[model samples]
Target: MNEVQTIDELVISFENHLRSLQRSRFTIRQYWQTWKPLKIFISANNIEFFDITVGKQFIKSKLGAYEYANLNQMQRRLVNTVDALSVFQQTGKIHFGSAPLRRNPPKVFTGEIGILMEGYINFRKTTFGLAKSTANNNIRSLYTLFLFLEDKGVQKIDDISEVYILFFIKNLNPSTLSVNHSTLGVVKGFLKYAYEEKVFSTDWSKIIQRTNYKGQPKLPSFFSTDEIKSILNSIDRSNSSGKRDYAMILLAIKLGMRVSDIAGLKFEDIDWDKHVLTFTQFKTKKSITLPLLPEIGNAIIDYLKYARAVSDESHCFLQQLSPYKKVTAEDVSRVARFYIHRSGISLKERKHGAHALRHSFASELLGNKTSLPVISEALGHGHTSSTMFYLRIDINQLRQCALDVSLVPSTFYQQKGGFVS
Candidate 1:
């Protein structure tokens, strides 16, 4: 909270804040060691106030590279430390334990079309009751559409036409059918909104049709049980952060809980007496319960007993450092990817995300001959139809539909080779 303007002074203040938060001495030392080099770099470069530009320069000078993906674990941690310092100085906000990992460019639109974009976003939120994350996604899609229109010399929603829509569709050049399907849904959704408001002369919504997800649904990435075991085993249970992450990963792998639901879990959601974990699903808003196996229960209790930050937060988990509060879904994914990488599993062909674990959990159930309705309920999906996609990866069941060529030879093969009976 100190309004320290200079990088040197701010670093001292930030360190003091961490100490007050009672962050482990080891973590504090790691941060201190990282900041020491940054201080020397800034001092040598004759820099006064610290910023990301200076931080990047320092990182490049030290590591001889600027690309984040190219950095090793220790080097990335160095970047995170420097980035955390930059954020602390600029925003006066300590992001608690870890530094900010992802930063997206600000979406900018400056015209009447921009105004309508804002109006449409607000309308969707108020009228349709869209969640914040959903609204943000819609805004990103609409931003792309409006950016194209603005380039085409359009200024209002009234200017949106079938021609403009066609150009937009053609310009997308999406890599996959699923991406194309989602892009069209955004266009159609916006068109419907514009037509209902009488902003567009033609009902362009009719001109565009979205693919039926039910007919051609996107297949989710799933992992084998052995792969999941590897990911879980990668976690070091001695640290507080590791304990929290271990528990969170179990929720995703064993319970099929979404990132949002895991991050938003409250203490009240746990029924210790009944050994049940109950919470409302964020995407569907339906309350459901899962049995709290001893392994998961033990993990959570270990975190609570020795790892959970001291705070009045109602959420089951908290940021391990000062200003302890709920974490974002992105934070959960980062943790997931970190361990997934450490586990050394070859997931380059598949998505390395927590959702894959959710898919894996569903597939495991399918392999166990769990019924579709039961899996649907267990997954907190609104319908069994939504859970049917798991069948694609149910190789055991799919084999039942295949004919054994060895057991019965076809007539064509008999004619071609003169097969003996």
Candidate 2:
């Protein structure tokens, strides 16, 4: 590796690399500012290579002088710099440690288990043609399993017993059915693969029972109509960020578009003349088209014409700050949360993310007696069953399904108070 002659050169190269990756200019500037102090410390000490010892010394020196806030900020920046340097030195590639999915498992699992995990991930991708997100989840699940094994001092895959598997299952959050089911599903899939590959003598997959979680159809948490209105009103449409957020929230509430789809929305997806919006569902991969309500269309137009940052990128929503890349799903959620918080609407038993807006949309439609199939189509649900859960919250519809107790014999009702013949 070519040694960085000067910290200035390294900073320049890192800044350029960040720009190449389309990192926001604000982020790049922050990184640069953070590195400046480190540069001074390194140059003063004549540190040749940035290593853990240098990092420790830098922290130790600054911890006493810097204020709490400044010190916290410096620590984060230093860690980011170290990560960037390490990646560059090892792979000859510039990575900002932004992609969690691309990260490898803990170093302890780098032996036999790691090889098997890699092979299993490849098998899932090539054999099953699973989505990148799904494959990533599977790999992460195996990593968790191996991490647990390492913690318990079991190194080899052959040494893994049913007791270890049961212990792992027991450790999962029992209240969270989805997490338990998904984790167990991935582990079992890996075990089956291992058995087929002769890594295990017996089919341990068969021994690991599926999670027996027959959970009730829980009502989807959503804001009330007034709360939704308050959230929308809370956004300061006078600014670019507010305008963008207002449009994104409308898309979620009016159309029930998933956060992912809203983040991935492009200019071409909307036809103003036709008053239609179309996009492929991120989760289901199904193409869906919906009528562009005047309210939603107007919000989007205000954002596009007045507020959206000028960028060559085609994504409908761009970050307010420089680099101005497309907004991510997490960004969409944050926007929702910010407005919801600003609105001062206290949510006790409901989610406050962008998805709550989606649930609100579904609840509104169901309240208006919209057919399940129509609501399903509107929400871009791949199956009507996916939409059925929303019905659990439709009290009016549920009331309609209730049996008319008034028709029952008086003897049947009065028998509890006094025995009636």
Candidate 3:
């Protein structure tokens, strides 16, 4: 899209969109007629782009003291048009004839600080090619600093310094070193952007740098062999949903497929002849093929034959209920959680998601003295380091690592009240 768009251009595009939606000729004409007032307003003000802020002002000027839901037909038409244009610009989607959308534009910024915040977010997205979610995370980290500057009467970005930076860092709630490091990186990057743009004079990016975090990650959750069996048994398997879920659980426990990979399973990803399954791993984007265990293949066959939803979607798993949508990664995880709870397993301090099943699968292999490299390959881990996370759950291996007591002083063990005297 062009960096700058005129009002007329947007309206023309919106008209094409309305036709694509298969709106009736008369309905499209009605929407087109409503666009005139907005066009006139944008022209009079010389707006280069029709943003939500301008849209709100247009509604106030045209409607002139009107209730939201209580608007007359003429007022409603104009408000909906503005709402549609606003939605089109922000999301590239039409929301025609929706008052609630016009009333509530997402997160409007009013002051200089808010304006700067908006710029930072836009720059981060455009320059770094960050996804919307990643950009939101950067905002989450930097918003506190923005507020701190405001509270300190530091209106100009020029006032930011080592002292203010230090103070802001001090007030943050203590978190893991990793979390703290991520937050610091965000602050430093924002400062770099500000300096390069001449919004702030100081080059404060040098104030913070990334460092390796040495702490061990907490042990991952896994079920015992019995607990895994119990979870599998909890499913009734009498109905379609039960049958569908049983197949899903087997994929996790038996193959150690990630929830995403399992939910995204396609019929073509399986080889009925060779007894193998192949699919691209979602997180790593690397393709992996695993031997399709006869039990897992059979379970999948049972689901496809009896219980699977009749969806046109190529994905193998689908919701049991109407609409019969393809199951999402969340859907699969929720299935795991549901049966884990029903199995009457103690979930205290243990993750009960599909991922825990993956952990259990690895731990089971480790218990059987499966080599780490072999287990790593079965888990489709790109590196053994990733597979090593499951090693902490092997209590016997950890016991072997326990320090030998041969070097300890004999006096330390014999010490008592009599020895002290």
Better of 1 and 3 by TM-score: 1
Score each candidate by Cα lDDT. Answer: 0.78, 0.75, 0.77
Q: 121-237 in candidate 1: lDDT tens per residue?
A: 888888977877688777777777876787688887667778998888777634344545765787688778877888777888898765565434456678898899999999999
TM-scores, all models, native as reference: 0.65, 0.65, 0.59
Listed per model in order, the count of residue pairs whose N, CA or C atoms clash below 3 Å is: 0, 0, 0
Task: Please say which candidate is ahead in TM-score: 2 or 3.
Answer: 2
Query: If ranked by lDDT, best first, what sequence of candidates would result?
Result: 1, 3, 2
In candidate 1, what residue range of length 10 has the lowest lDDT sum? 63-72
Model 2, residue 127: distance off in Å is 4.9
In model 1, what lDDT does residue 154 have? 85
Root-mean-square deviation per candidate: 12.0, 11.5, 14.6
**What would you estimate as the lDDT of candidate 2?**
0.75
Enumerate residue pairs that collide in model 3: none
